[model samples]
Target: MNNPEVYDIKAKLEAIHQDIKRLMEKSNQEYLDIMLANLKNDLINSLTSYVSDDIEHGLHRGMVDPCQMRETCKSRFTEFLENNTSLIGQENVSKNIIDEKRAELDEIRETAPFDKCDICFSEVNSLFEKQLNLISSRQIYSNTEKKQTEISSIPEELMVKSVLEPLSNKQRLQILKSMASETMTFTALSELTGLRGGNLLFHIQKLLESDLILQRHERGDYMITKKGYNLLLMLSNFLKFLEK
Candidate 1:
């Protein structure tokens, strides 16, 4: 009630969320490209400097053998991991952890295979998991500087209650899950969730009140808002991490 422009805030949040997602995707690809290129250069330099009596030339016809160099680089990377395991407070990095992380990364890759860089996705997940593990093992300082100076223009308690209210129902959660992947019309959503028109409308009104879903003015289709998507994602991640 304090802020008349509630929908405007929702729009701004969604726009910012989309911009950040695009930047992340772009940066991921660039980071992977540069990282692999640097590794290739390093491997070439190493192979070129060392000449065995058996194989006199590192290059075959003035170019590095990519197939052989790739194998050599893998071996070197394995060795590096072995040597630096203690730096991370572990005797050895677990193969199970690597496989688990790879599985999660593969799921993300499969969702948009052509859009994501696999190596970057895998690396990001691995790092995120490691950070979570570290945090669980030790206490970390919380950042409270912004919280100290920030003033809420709206009633903070009211906003919190409104955001949480729609999420407290089983039917509402099912509705959100149904619309997570795509926008849906009232009829389509009703069929998907098997809810009657009257009941579905009631749940939807709650979602709209919370600003978790947006309704199209022209066609009456409903879509999950950015806050809704982030809430689901955060909840999924938190449950997984906490369970471990």
Candidate 2:
């Protein structure tokens, strides 16, 4: 029977186990060690639970698909993390640390090569939905408080000026409109806007200063941020109001 993917997954599982074991040993914190061990066990169970079933059904019948194996195991790991925040010790783990790690892992998953396995992809997607739910719930709580504080502390006049100044330029307006659809690189933006060199850089800087766009550090793609999307919605409403 074809089972190379199983073996490959087993090897990766062992590597992950060893990595956690080393971290646990190095930290020498009993609570942390216990947490890491629990995490490692969860990952093992997630990977191997489907192995026997797959063998019985003849799923891995062809050449080894490395991406499939890796993504499957990694998704399991992520799921464990999302579902088991209790693994974090009351004294040792900060919620901020967990949040940062989750954000980092999610960014990696987003940029990963597309997965062709529908089954594996579905599992990953479900886990992502769970993660998003958790994040949204947390953000709603925190942002409610944060928004109230900002509203009290920040001047409305200043906020209006900051927002309106960025929308003052016709060329910058065009750039923002295009970015609302999809991210573009510097060259793409230049071509789209027919602006280049210092002229393009000036507009991009203006958007950056306004926090309306985010630039990918490695790829240099400029994408609209949440603030930018909300601004666009507000612009639409304002235009409708004017029409009325």
In the range 67-126, model 2's lDDT, one tens digit per residue, is 646546554445444443433222233356557656865664565555554544455445
Q: TM-scores of all models?
A: 0.36, 0.36
Error of 1 at 235 (Å): 0.9
Tens digits of per-residue lDDT, candidate 1, 1-244, equal 4475888888899999999999999999999999988985664344323222102222122222344343443343333333322223332344455456457545644654233234433444454455334423322212322443465356777766665677888888888877789988988878877889688889999998888889978657899998888888977998999999
Clashes of 2: 0
Off by over 4 Å in 1: 1-156
In candidate 1 the C-alpha lDDT for residue 150 amounts to 65
User: How well does candidate 1 match the true structure in TM-score terms?
Assistant: 0.36
Clashes of each: 0, 0
**Candidate 1 backbone overlaps, count:** 0
